[model samples]
Each structure stands twice: as structure tokens, then as C-alpha cells.
Target: MEDRNNNNNEIYALIIGAGISGIVLARLLAEKNQKVLIIEKRNNIGGNCYDYIDKNGINIHKYGPHIFRTDNGKIWQFLSRFTAWHEYKHKVRAIIEGKEIPIPVNFTSIDTLFDTTKAKVFKEKLISKYGKNEKVPILELKKTDDKDLRELAAFIYEKVFYHYTLKQWDLKPEELAGDALARVPVYTSYYDGYFTEKYQAIPQNGYTKMFENILNHPNIKVQLNTDFKDLKNTKYKYLFYSGPIDEYFNYRLGALPYRSLNFEFKTLPQKQFQSVAVVNYTSKEPFTRITEFKHFFNQKIGQTTVAYEYPAAFELNKNERYYPIPKQENEQLYKKYLQLAEKEKNIYFIGRLGEYKYYSMQSAIAAIFELVKKIAT
Candidate 1:
């Protein structure tokens, strides 16, 4: 529970971004009686998971909607220390063939899409082949040669995942690695929740307040609008960098590929905009989905805030890098950066941007926990 440990020669660890990875590592180091300084490029912290109460009295995620869900007890317990959580179950529906149906195209979604007899038959066939209540990847479903399964797969792929993938990543399924297609899965049950993790909820107050609580320790010093390059000449015993890994070494080998996003916010006078928190347009819509922010916490407010998500290619100094493109070439290029990072004992690459992987919020926290455990040992 100690804040600032004054015995570490005045300079202990310098953490390069005040995002979840940075903050968690800073708090861990601070607890170990080490002083930590955090520098952030933007005026605020929290990285892509940042959320705040907007001017219209609605909590809006500056990035897209980030619903916290994880099966790891360690990650949940670590985050629970900072803030109370809203135990809200999130359900996502997609507008397909002019009907709003549950995503992953569950049994209910199938019923909604097909006629009664056909839906029942398809359900029976799916159960006979894969068993009930099992989650199957769309590609796996397409692997079947049964005409009925083929029809079912075609419908779901064309209406649920295919166009959506194209819109979200701007790449066909064939172009990317096999793991990329696993992002979307088909549920063989009536379950409608977007996530199947053991724990799923949102921070009660908002992400910002929770982050503030974590970084409030006297040992953790935070400086806003601070660039890492400006403080490059300054030295610390340890530097946990959570910024882009390639950018850290000035893209010495080559710039790793990434996907950014453009978020558009709208405040409507009505209490609710959509039935569900998120509604995906699986068609060739320019924008992917619309999120009604209030649903995250079930906030009782007169007006509702909604955000439209548009995926864009990551450009230098343009949009924020949200996702690392998971392809063979990109992974190979990242490995090259990893080799470079291995040589720098003073700097440790941390988090999504730094590691060049799409680590979920909980995943990032867990990774930080492991990193600090190693430091402690």
C-alpha cells in the first residue's frame, strides 16, 4: 500500500504511456517500493479503453464501446481494486436481410432468418453434426458438404461475417491468416450475449475514474501531453514502454501493419436509440456498428449517446492504432522488432501497441501482472 518509495535513488522506473498496461505496471512497481513516472502523448490516459462522461450527461467511450469481459480471476480481481463494476450482460444484434437478429447467428437468429420448419431442420442437422450449445467457427460450418449445412453456412457467412469482415478489416478472409476468421463465431444455442466469458461488466463510474484511482498513488507521477521522444535523453533504471513497438526504434526494420478506427458520436433527445447496446450492419455499410453508450451501465438519463464506428487503415500520425493486423508477414516483421527489443535491457515493450498484438483489456492487465511478477522475482 506504499505510494512513493523515496529510497530508490530518486529515479526508479519510467513508464511510457499511462494506458492500462502502463498504469497497472506503475501501480505494481509502486507497491514494490519503487517510484514510477508516467508520460502520455494525449491529454489523458486509458488508451483505447478510455471512457468519460460527455457534455450531454452521457458516458461515452472516446474509442468504441469497450465491454470488460474476462475468464481470468486474477485480471478481474486486479481491476476490481480500482472501481466498482456494473454487472450488465451485453447482447448484440445484427441487421441482416432486413431483420434484426442475434449475432453469431444463434438458434433464435436462425429461427428469425429462416422459416419455422427449415430453421428447425437446420438446428437438428447442426446438433446431429456438432452437438448442441457448442460454439463453432463460421469457417468450420462451411467445411461441411451437406446441402442444408451448405445453405446455412452460406447464409450466415454472406449475411453475418463476410461483408462485415471486409468492412471492418478491408481484407478478404482468404488474404489473412486462418486465425483471423476465428474473430466471429457461431453459437449452437439460444444464448444471445456477445461475450461468453465468466465475468462481463463495465466500470461503475467510468474508465477514467477507475484509471485515476489506480494512478493516484504518491509513487506514481503522471504528466499529460508528454511525448516519449522529448524525454528520450532522460534515463531511468527501467522503462516500461506501451507505445508502438516499431515507432520506439524508429521503424528500424519496417513499420508493422495496423488497423485504426474513426468514431462518430451522436446525442439523441430520446431515452433510447436501439433495443440492444450494439447493432451490427453486416452488409456493405460504410460504417460497421452503432453503440448506444448508456446501455453499458444502464444509466438513467433523458438523452442517449450513440457512436458510429468506421474502420480505417492506420496512417502515420493520422488515426489511433486500435488493432494490429494479424498476418504472417506482419508477425514476421514484429518478430524482428521483438529481437531488437530483447537487446534493450533498459526498455521493456509492454501492452497491445508495444507488443504489436490485439490484447484485450483484461489480457493487457494480466500480461502486466506477469511482467511485474518477473520483476519481483
Candidate 2:
């Protein structure tokens, strides 16, 4: 960790991990006449949203396809200034039992899976049974002492929810949190769009270009392939850390559990492959989903690229951090770290990994804006 103290009158801010949140925070602080230095462990800036051309000359996301979508008008408008809009709306389908059904498992999917008479009867039964309360967890339904409701709940649990959740998280449905299950919204309508957010689209160029624009200011200096541990002895006025909360403190409070993913990208000599952008495999397949790159960017190219995502156990050093497992045990562990974070006055933990919460890209940017506002006031 080489620390060169620049004798500048401006406020010095050190941001760890040049991810979306980190970049946004740096931009906001730099605009306020603060001297900002962004240190990224990876050789690139866009973190999980990073994309580049593969050996086959096909542009692919290093992590996965990240579609920019949010209901916040300010966030949408703000991102627009960096890159032109692609005018793309993402839709995903799940391949379950040899059939491709619209994801979020809507009315059309249910109808397609079952016979017309049985489907109608089942729909009526569900409406009459659960009413307009909206579907909760299978466990919640199982708690009902009523035998028939419990049976129905068990049926849905086994058929619809169990295998898919198991494949996605690599854990049993009962082992997972009710909150995780709650995040999966069940729709009665034929809406097949993956996200229900009002404003949804991707950048025309790429997320990398957008991030480059964000960090292009004079006051912001970027250092890639630099780990936070490398700068342990460095002195800064304040630190904005977007890396794992547990890793920040050397996991003294025990490593906060996280779920990781393994992506396998393949190139083919074809224009198109899948029907949609993303296809979820809900069965017991080793790979959970396959994504076609062209569907995401709507690029007209000769060669095509696709990625097969496989969910795996998150080892300490082997895997790239993806999803944070927010079970009761993990939450208790995070609470200990949260207390530690409060004691550290000079350090501010932001974004999903830092705060140990599942946040959308828009929510992460909104957090930066909030922090900037607080600092200004």
C-alpha cells in the first residue's frame, strides 16, 4: 500500500472497489470539489456490470447480463446522461419439464403447463382459497392448520417453488428464508416482463462506457487491480468501501455467508440461439440458466455468445461474490459487523456487499445520492 499524500486543500475521499456504487459516489464527491481516488481489485471499473469482447469477437458480460431498470425517474435520467438509451425491455423464460414458460411464472405459464379444465379449476380454487391477499410463502401456507390448504400449499411447494429455488440457491426451500421466497412475485395476469419497474432499458454502448464517463472527471483518479488490503496502512480523510463487510475487518466476526455463481460462456457461428435474452432452467440441471447476449443488446452480428450460469457453494477464496445469503444466522453475524462499522467513524460502508443487503443497481445509486446529500448538509 503506497500512500502519497497530495498537498491539496480539497477534501480527500478514498473509494474502494470501482463498482457502480463506488463510481457514482466518486463522481458525486468529485463534483463537490473533493479529491477522490477509486481503488478497484479487478483490472476493470464496472465490477459485476463489466463487459468486454471475448476471443470469438462477441461482446459478453464477465459476470452476467445486467439490464438497467428502475422506477426512479431521477436515476433513469442521470444514467441517460452517461450513455444513450437502447430502448430495450428484458423478458425471461424458464425451461421447466421440457417446456419454455414465461418467467415470474404467470397465468400463461400455469395455463400452458396444465389442461384447460384443470387449469381453470385450479385458478378458481386458488382465488377462492387464498383470495386477494396475494401469495405469501409456502411455509406460511403450511402453517395453516387446515389440511386441504396445507396439501395445496405442499403441492405448489413441490411443483412450482421447490426445485427451482433449490437449483438457484443450492439449498432446500425450507432452509432458505421466507423473505427470499417473498421476493419472487406471483402474477395472475399474462405479463411476462421479468421486472415490473416503470423505467427499464440498457445503455446503448455498454455499462463500462457509462462508468468510464462517470469517473472521467479531473479530481477522480482510478487505480485498477488494487486490493483494499494493499492499502491498509494508507491514510485518508474518509473511506467509502463497497467490498464485502466481513472482508473489510478480516472476518474477525466470522465470514458473512454469501452465495456465488459460475458462468460458462460459449461462442457459436449463429446469429441467434435462445428465444429470449435469459432462460432459467428450473429443473435439477447443473446449470441454472443460459443467456443469449444479442437479446440483451439487440446487436446485429454474425457470431453469437451465450452464457450458462451455475450456482455453487461460496468458498472463502475460490468464488467471486454474487448473492448474499440473508438467512437468520447470516443476519446475526452481520449485526456484529454493523456494530463494528458504527464504531469506525472514518469508514462508511455502502452498496449491497458493504451493507449486507440485496439491492438493485438503481437503489445502490440512490444510496450514493443520499450519502452525498448528508455530507453536504
**Candidate of highest lDDT:** 1
Q: What do the candidate models score in CA lDDT, each in turn? A: 0.87, 0.80
Model 1 residue runs over 4 Å out of place are 1-9
Clashing pairs in 2: none
Candidate 2 regions with alpha-carbon error over 4 angstroms: 1-11, 55-57, 124-156, 232-234
- The residue pairs in collision within model 1 are 3-219
Q: Scored by Cα lDDT, where does model 1 land?
A: 0.87
CA shift of 377, model 2, Å: 2.1
- Give the true-structure RMSD of model 1: 2.2
Give the per-residue lDDT digits (tens) of candidate 2, residues 1-377: 11234456544788999989999999887777778989999889998889876666555788988888888999888888788877787888877667787867666776887778766765665566566435444566667666655654565566667887888777787787647887665555567787778888877778898899989998899999899887766566888999999998999988888888999878889989989989877767788789998887677888888999998888987988888886888888988999999999778999889998877789899998898888776
Candidate 2 lDDT score at position 354: 96
Q: Provide TM-scores for the models.
A: 0.96, 0.89
Q: After superposition, how far is residue 196 of candidate 1 from its true place, in Å?
A: 1.0
* Error in Å for residue 275 of model 2: 0.9
